[model samples]
Target: MADIGGVNSFRSFARSWRRAASFAEVIPRRPSFVLAPEGEAVDDSSDWDMDDGRSHIDGSSEHSTAHSRQHLLRGPSLQSQGSEAIAAEFSDGASDALLGGSPSTRSSIFDVPPHLAAADVIGSHSIRYGTINSVRYRSRPSVNHDSPWGVHDEQIDPEAAAMTFGEDNPILVKEVKQGDKVVLTVEGQSTLPQSVFNSINAIIGVGLLSLPLAFKMSGWIIGLFILTLTAAVTAHTGKLLGKCMDYDPSIVTYSDLAYVAFGTRARIIVSALFTLELIAACVALVILFSDSLSSLLAGFATATSWKCICAALVLVLNMIPLRWLSYTSILGIFSTFCIVCIVIIDGLVKKDAPGSLWEPARTHLFPSNWMSVPLAYGLMASPWGAHSIFPSIYRDMRHPHKWERAVNTTFSFSYALDTCLAVVGVLMFGDGIKDAITSNILRMSDYPESLTVVMCIFITIIPLTKIPLNARPLITTADVVCGVHREHAHGADAAAQPSALVHGVRALIRVVVVLVLLGISILFPAFDSVCAFLGAALITLISIILPISFYLKLYHKEITTRERVLSWFLLVIFSILGLVGTIWTFLPKQLVAA
Candidate 1:
């Protein structure tokens, strides 16, 4: 009987595997544009690498060409040759590509016919069409000073370079035709190590500070389970995003991916969500900066006063361009590491049992109140909520195939760091843990004063630096909306600098934005609450639901039953969790008592 059961189980597994294999075999890569005859002009920039961000077009095709080469798209191009076959690749047959295999196998870049270069391209701001064998490409610009986005285009063997010209690959942003000779820009890519470093940087942030409290709110055991579960699920969704990008290497940003999945409506919704998230994040930073500083200087001033002062300081500093502070951005990761070390060291040195630092407390395996578990869900989700930019990191990678490994490494490191903090906090404070573990550490009866000062400095200064980083994109978006910035144009003035009026308006807008952030922070001063709400709402949708939905939507027919089932299950679970947590956050305490 045992042998028969074993055989039956094996058969079931084999059948399921076959079903998956069949589905994989049936999916088709998104259709690419058919190659037009040489000299036949086509306007297809809208079909590829389209972004909402204003294109920075310099009249010099050389600069644009250099930029395009740094961002080479790796995927199979459309091999069909005909004028009638060109259509938007957004259709079902064109978008349903199965994902697997290395970059070399999963993609084959066919040479684009020489004449296709006459049309406007989509890969970079400006692309000069170059013929394969006779192509004259330039080396990438200086890495240290020119490429702020960290682009590097190294020279490859000419024979190997010829394979990157399929119609579906290497988009030309602005076609600069100079005497028939195609000027192809072959760009270099970010290596596996660089990609891993970037992914780690994105994943680790202020959110880790809240994990200790998350464990306190949910049962420590439940929190541990939830942390592990959230990491795995979020990483899976990140991979889904990578798969979506795989279908069309042109998908550069989260909003771009949305546009691919459900058209204009999806793009608008995702873009709006991203904008709101940025504003909310700035508000949170304001509160965090003020909160940390006020804790240290309790008798100095009112909380509202502290917030305004900080906002003013940050606004003044942010008026300087992002490039000025680009180097300081890396300090964010170091600050987080330092905070974690302080928490661990303090947790070890302090011999106090649960509740000694505050009110009576006790360590528990389960939460006393299950109602708070959803909030914990949001809190735990925060640390793994960097999915908004995962697509960007994936696109920048030299070996796009190693994206899964990068995601795994990032999550593993984050999980280990979060777990260490949560365990120490739980063992020491239990339910009494503050929203920020650092806050709880500061209250310890015998805590080191020097360490408390250092923790406070990290909390305050780091947010100050981040506020501008978060606000810069929003400011640029505002500039476009207000016409302070212009679209792509021709002539010597195409790359002309913004006028004085434009500069004045930009500075005014930045001030208004900072003031608005200050107002919101003053109104909602709870750091944990802000973090939880953002995590529950925006982060949940961005990091969890949307990626899965987009992937399933794009590859609906091609995906296996198991894949579909698992995806839907995760979708339902997280949707409910986010919704419940968001609603609970605003519910009246009186209603809860009833």
Candidate 2:
């Protein structure tokens, strides 16, 4: 009985051992398995055999079997189709291939998640994940790949990818078409508007009668003076502009002119001068607008309120960037040109008009002769003769060689217009030019309607665009002077040292100069006095004096002795004449108060 019990126990132990070994062989030691679930496996033998149209075993197989039987030859192990055992066998083969000899030969194919295998195949050319494949093919990452999934891959076509993505992007594909190319087509552009064309024709048809409508009442002498001043100032500014262009080869402004003329130290001086000028301009505008509005609108308007509004508008305009302000200046120029053209046409065509548009009547066109000179001079200097802005204009011209042509054209045009208007005013109004000329054309017209008011507003607003251009130098100067005390210093290591402080101090000095000017304007608030004083003082200094000084300084070596003497003589004459004229005009008896 004991022997039989021992035999049964040994048999059971052997059976248990055999079962454990089978399990170990069938199940891999890995933590995860990639084979299909136990019940999901399907035999692929019938499918493969049917596709071949051949028997699984054949006569060749019989012959191979006989040879194998004779030699007991061993062949590669074949796994059962779709079986877990087959999957394990394939996995082992792949692992062996990856890590066969060199470690570098190893691959991640076997380690890749089965679920992502399809994605890998489709996106293999992408940079984000296909760098390995690209390296295998070309030994470098492809740069042309633009697939989001393969951002690092270069093999893919970026243009193709962009087109695919861009198809859905509206902002990327917007296009503008040329409207009309034919010069004489119905849709073609006409240089002037219909209203302007009609006005021009009407004025020309009426002869001298249109002079009243044009309000050109100042007289030929005043007109000639304005023309001369405009031409001289423009010529001087253009020359300076040319020099500035040689230095920077880029668009510059009045501030830039200061920098070029005086070095970085000039920034503050220019800025202070500009700021003061703008403040004065703004105040003047407010006062002018308020006075006009109070008279026109009666109870609805007050000088104080209009002044506030003008101040606010100036501040808002100044806050705008320099580029925008430049655009505004261009606009102002265009508007002024148009208005001047209209006025000239009216004056040239008018018949039986008031003897000189300046003569006292229902309404006067030109301001008093005393005021007209300074006002016209200031207007010309403000925009057309802005010497400080010359450098920038010079820099932007495509053909710097043609700069003289542009300058000549601009000044010539300005002179013709200013002279015509002044002559017409004086011819029409005689001694009454002072009473006729007002802040706007409408103010000089009998009917003073909405159109006139609108035109006046537009024309006046245009010049104010230059205020910021004038103010920048002051700010820069302030920075230079006061910024040195700060913890950190700018431009200290360069050849030029911190001139910003110096500039700032200069700006402060300019501020004082501007304040003095304002005080003078306020004290002698008469329009005629302000115009004459400013024209004689500011225009003469900026136009004649400065130009001569700069030219002498810049070309001293090249200038002949006679030229030098001439320059000095001209400078002294201009200074004396300017001083005398300014003083005479500002005298209480001669002044025409605003």
Candidate 3:
């Protein structure tokens, strides 16, 4: 009886052991490689295959395998140790073939995530996760050979590339380098509607006020044709500029386009031209301010005194951060739109007033003075020179793909406003129209007092607001030239308080710039001449010539024959207009009148 009881106990014990073993096999365990302590024996016959899920034939003797395992365990550093361990596990008879590198070289496998570590690890038993062949580990820097900016095989800048591809949503990426480190920054994007508003605001400025005089000089027939042609060509070039950016993500400014198409010399030349254009615009603003206020404050002060007042105000107001200025910039658009409405309403209501269409007028179907036609063309072209800012607007957009739509909408709205003002001014004032349409309205009697007050307020406010805005680029360029900008540009130093000396220097430079602009305004207060010259010379190059030239140079191979023809034709026409206008600028008004 005792022997039988002992046998039953042994049987029960055996059954319990079997059940425990089965349960242990069923339980899921985190997958990991088992490593032996230093100098321990490693199994040469693979217990579990690390590759091919089959028994690994250790064609390398057991001694060699053990020696390699020991070497991997004693790797120089933690990162390197991890690399060697991976290479050892993946190694076959030809270790280099399996490791994807030489035995002495470290593997990039350590740089990959665990899941991605399964890539090319076919049927491996050590790692049971499903394998993916799609995303392979990249051991080399990515080179973009197809950049439209003519930068070929250029290794993408890591900081800039991170900004470009690291995010899910599109962003305006910038990189600031300090010492040896790089800092990346991203700015929030503007929506389509916001972009459209900004684009329109850029287009509609003091230029709109001069269009009436522009029409008077060009005549109704020639004026309308030139206006239409200029708008269409400039808008098209703006679109081309956006596409150029699309082809090369690195380009962030108009000058960058020039650099890619040509070289550093081109970049410097383009930047200098753009700088001159901005300075000219600042001069125009001063003239516009003085003219508007001088007309309003008629016997109280001369235009020179008003110009001095404007300079003082600009120097003070520019001290306000550009961010705050941008917020108030929307008022400029509203002011301009209001001025247009007042002009249309006043012109229609006072139809029988002096110089109205009902009166005998010197309205010309063609330019009475053929020499003035170039001047007229320049005036008409002035308002369309918003191309410099298009790249900035494009960069700020949330949906950059919708850029063409925004361009079309902005140009269409601007054109309509321009056309409305031009037609009404010609009909109401005929040859009596002053350079500023508002000046014409202000001089006439029976004009609604409320409308005149509104027009005066709007026109005067515009130049005051625009002066600092237009001068912003020059101020920044000054900062760079003075060497103060670099001290602040360092990313690590961004939060550090700027020195008072730097502040004082910047203030002094700004004062000098504003004072110089004041002198120019006082020296050459011919508002129409300045506007016409800018339209004829700078605007033609920036808006018409540069964009088309850059586009042709960048996309010479890809662009169709039709596009090529149209681009060259525009180049020819605008080149003539620019040259003629330049000649008109230098010619004496007395001589031209004769």
Arranged by TM-score, best first? 1, 3, 2
Question: Per-residue CA lDDT of candidate 2, range 1-594, in tens?
Answer: 323544234333332222111111000111111111112112333322221211112223323223222111111121112234334544553443322333223222222211112222211211111111211222233332322122232232322322322211000100111121000000101111211221121111101212222233233344445447546754754565464333322112444334334433444454444444334443343444455554555577554665455444554554564435534544444555555555544444444355323332333343444443433444333323244334433432323455566566555554555545545555545444442233334445543255456555654564355434344334333333343311111123223454666556654554543444344434545444344444455556655666566566545665689978977887886677566666665455535332
lDDT of 3: 0.61
Q: Identify the leading candidate in terms of lDDT.
A: 3
TM-score between candidate 3 and the true structure: 0.68
The regions of model 2 sitting more than 4 angstroms off are 1-219, 222-226, 233-237, 240-284, 341-384, 434-440, 448-450, 463-524, 589-594
User: What TM-scores do the predictions have?
Assistant: 0.70, 0.48, 0.68
Q: Indicate which candidate wins on TM-score.
A: 1
Cα error, residue 264 of model 1, in Å, equals: 1.3
- The whole-model lDDT of each prediction reads 0.60, 0.37, 0.61
How far out, in Å, is residue 536 in model 2?
2.2
CA lDDT for candidate 1: 0.60
Selected candidate, larger lDDT, 1 vs 3 = 3
Residue 120, candidate 1: C-alpha displacement in angstroms: 20
Task: Compose the digit string of candidate 1's lDDT tens values, residues 239-266.
Answer: 8888887664445457656655665456
lDDT of 3 by residue, 179-290 (tens): 2222222221456666776677778877778888888888889999999988998899899888775544334456545655664456567666777677777788788777
